[model samples]
Each structure stands twice: as structure tokens, then as C-alpha cells.
Target: MTDDKTLVSRVLQGDMQAFRLLIGQHERLVAHMIGRLVKNNEEREELCQDVFLKVYEKLSDFSFQSKLSTWVATIAYRHAINWMRKRKMPMTDLAEEDHFKAAFVEEENPESLLSDQDMNGFVMTLVDALPPQYKTILTLYHVDAMSYDEIGQVTGLPEGTVKSYLFRARNLLKEKVKKCIGKEELL
Candidate 1:
């Protein structure tokens, strides 16, 4: 089991198995990014595969001027953008969205949202249901624990916009959490 740098060097030397090692080292990373950036399960799966393929094809271009993760993230961001363009969704501000209002607009009863497991699951499902713009922002902010500037870099949005998106996403989740918790009393 070689390290990433060693494996990268081997892959550069034309060893097919080196690619495997690279995938093994970064598969979870690729999946995490895909899952966060893409809400649709099918597209998430496809995008992950595409990222790995792109990584394999572009191995020669990696000059070690930057870390491997950064290079991979750059590819993922580009692919995600291309995917969004293909889907015909023009740029939209998720910060301006009232996600909870858009999804549950009406006041839901406590029971309507109560078990801790049920509450957590429902909130996560709701996040998953967010539009890609919001979902990507939420995922990058929460799941990846990325900073606003980092998220802005990845999403090609302004740092202020990234901050606003995260703020909005958290507010939406807080509301959902409250509703889910209320179910115990609503019952």
C-alpha cells in the first residue's frame, strides 16, 4: 500500500494499479463532494464516476504545483458547473430562498414533522430535497466543513454570497429542527 504521492508517481510511470490506489485513497472524498454538490442520487453517482475518470485522464497535467486534493476539487467544481449548465439552471441566489417556506410553506403540526430519529431523518431529507444551488452550499458548508472563502472558490460565487447561502441554509435547517422537535408536543 503506497502513499498518495508514491502512487501518483507510479501512475505517472504508467502503472495501471497506481490508478487503483489513487481511487482507493480518494474515492470517499470524491463521493462526499459529489453527494454534497449533487442532490440527485443518480447524478451524484454519475458525477463521482466522472470525477475519477477525469482524474485518471488528467494525471499527466498534475505538476504537483498544487496538492492532489485541490486539483481534484478543481475538476469536481468544473464538472458540477458543466452539469448545472446542461440542466439549464442559470445562476440563482440560494441566500434569497426561503427553503423551508418553499418546501413546507405552511405551519406543520408537531407530530406532523417526533421521534429524534424521525426528526433528524426528516431534516436531512429536506436538505437533500433542496435545489442544487442551496444543497451544494449546505453540503459544502456543513458536510465538508469548508470555510466561506473555500466554498466561494469551489462554487465560483463571491465570498459574501457563500456566507449568505450558508446562513440561509442553517436558518432553514434550524426551522426544520424546531418543527421536528415540536412533533413530540404536537402529538
Candidate 2:
């Protein structure tokens, strides 16, 4: 496996091919990570580019004090939050009511991969409805699958805080999803 250290070191040494390799390795991961923070599609894509550009520009400063993925992820997280904050939406924790599985999504048919798309779409709507904080954390947790510690490093919060934010965000999304389902049933 071409580890992050090797790739980062080579790229920092001015290896252009290594840059491509690094981008290939990290582009989707970075995009997905940032995408969770910003809701605007065009802006998200632009921010994704900006995130990589920042990563490239700052490549030399990388001391390998952390893994390349973490370093890059930190960049994405910071910039994504910056963009959100600039747009006047900072992330916040959700209330407890929405956290339980019963509120947002009930268990579904086990044999039904066919329903996955619809379900995911429904979930995405709930996710998008979250406050920027919860949206960002939830996106990082579920979409990027980063650990609490890693997310903390990225967001400049403690690991415990990251976990709390995630919990609150999930609850908020669950509440929204539940409200949406109820509204649909009423119509």
C-alpha cells in the first residue's frame, strides 16, 4: 500500500506524479468530507477544489506529525466550516427528542436492497435539514466514517465534543425526518 506518508513526502519533494496520486487517493474523500459541511452544490464543489488547492499549497508545511489523510481532512473541515460560518450558519447540537431510532427511521425490510436508494434519499433530506454543525458532524461520521478523534482534530473540537455534536445532529435529523413522514401521511 502506498501509505499517506510516502505519498505526502514524495509530493512535497516536487514529484508531480506523486501529486496526481495523492489527489486521486484523496479527492473523493475530501469532497465527501467537505460536502457535509456546505449545502450548496456548486459552492460545495468549489470549496472542494479550494480544499485541495489549500492542501497543495500547504504541502510543504506538512511535517508528517499526523497522517496525510488527517492533515488533508483537517484542511477540508476547517475550510468547510469557514464557508458555513461565512454564510452565517454555524453548527449546533440538536435536542434529544430526535436521537432515538424510532423518531427518524424505523427498521426496514432486511432483504430489500431495492429500497436502499429511496431510503438513502430520505435520509439525505433529513441530513440536509440539520443545522450546519449537526450536518457537518453527521456527514463526517456517516459519510466519511471518520473516528471521533479524527473529527475532533479536523473541527478543532475535543473528541468528546465531536461525539456530542454527532449525537445531537442525529437527533435533529431524526426529528426532521419524523416530521416529514408525519406530514406526508397527513396529506
Candidate 3:
């Protein structure tokens, strides 16, 4: 397989196949970033295409300052954010924290939940209930395995803020999972 540098060089020379190869290489990273941010499936698909379009247009300016996936993810993040902003959608709902806390404060038993066969589905539903910003950070950190700095760059957050949000997001998941499972140390 050709390295990113070779593919990039080929694309810079107007190789369409190289551009397609680049898209194939980074599509999952783009999808994962945008999927966590955009809730609408059709819109998410369109946004993914737009991200690659933007990447192709701006490829000449890519300075190799970061991994290609990181750069593509940054574009995907910004594109999703812009799409939400244009639609007047709130990225992070402050009221959600209070509701999440309320859920955490409720009493329940983990043993009962352990009997259910679809624990993974249940946990995904809870994750879906979280704020979009938290979902995005959590996906980037845990799913994409990006560093806090990479997350910060992709989301335009400070490194410390990325770390803080990731920490809080995980705790929120843990708390919610505990609530569902009755305090069996879900995390």
C-alpha cells in the first residue's frame, strides 16, 4: 500500500484515483466524527460528502502538521458544527446536565439488568441521550483513539477542555450505566 505522502503527492498532481484512495482511507474517521455530531442519517451522509469535498479543495494547504485522519476529522467536525449552527440547533444543552444528574441520583439494581441480553443496546440508548458535544468528544477519544490534543484540534477546544469533557463524559456514561445495572461497577 502506498503511504499517505505518496497518495497525497499523487493527488496533488491531479490524480483522481489518489483522491479516491484518500477518501477511502479516511472515510471511517470522517463518518465516526460526523455520526457522533449529526443525528439525522440523510444529513450525516450529505455532510460526510461535503467534508471530503472540502478536504479535496483544501488539500494543497494541508501542511502535514497532523495525521491525515486528524485533518479530515477536523474538517468533518467543523462541517457538522456549521450545519447545526445554520439550523439553529444547540450543540450542547445545559439543561441536559441537570437531567443526567437526576437520573444518576435515582436508585436501581444492577443484578436485574445483568439478566437482559441486550445490555449493549441499552447502553447505546443512554449514550444517545447525552449532549452532542459529549458524544463527539467521547467518540473521538474512545472510538477513534485520538489524543486529547487531536480532539482539541478537531473540535476547536483547548487540550484541557477536551480532557475535562472526556473525563466528564465517561463519568456520565458510568453513572448512567450504574443506574441501569444497579451499581455493579459499570465502568
Specify the highest-TM-score model's number: 3
> Compared with the true structure, what per-residue lDDT tens digits does model 2 show for residues 1-187?
5888788888888898998888888888788777766767889889988988899899989887767787898898889877767877734544533333332344553224235567677677567656656777788788878888877877788988888889877666655555555444322
- Computed on alpha carbons, the lDDT of every model, listed in order, comes to 0.71, 0.73, 0.81
- TM-score of every candidate: 0.73, 0.76, 0.86
Candidate 1 lDDT by residue in tens digits, 1-187: 6756788889889898888878887777677677755668888888988998999889888877655765676678778778878888554555455544565645655555444347556667778656566777787677766777667766778998877777777766666656556433322
Candidates 1 and 2: which is better by lDDT?
Answer: 2
Best by lDDT: 3
lDDT of 3 by residue, 1-187 (tens): 6788888899999999999999988899998878876878999999999999999999999988988888889999889988989999866663368655543324544554446647776676566667878888888887789998899888889998888888888788887776666656546
lDDT of 2 at 159: 88
- Cα distance off (Å), candidate 2, residue 139: 1.7
Candidate 2 clashing pairs, residues 3+ apart or interchain: 91-133, 98-171, 99-171
Model 3: colliding residue pairs = 109-181, 109-182, 110-181, 110-182
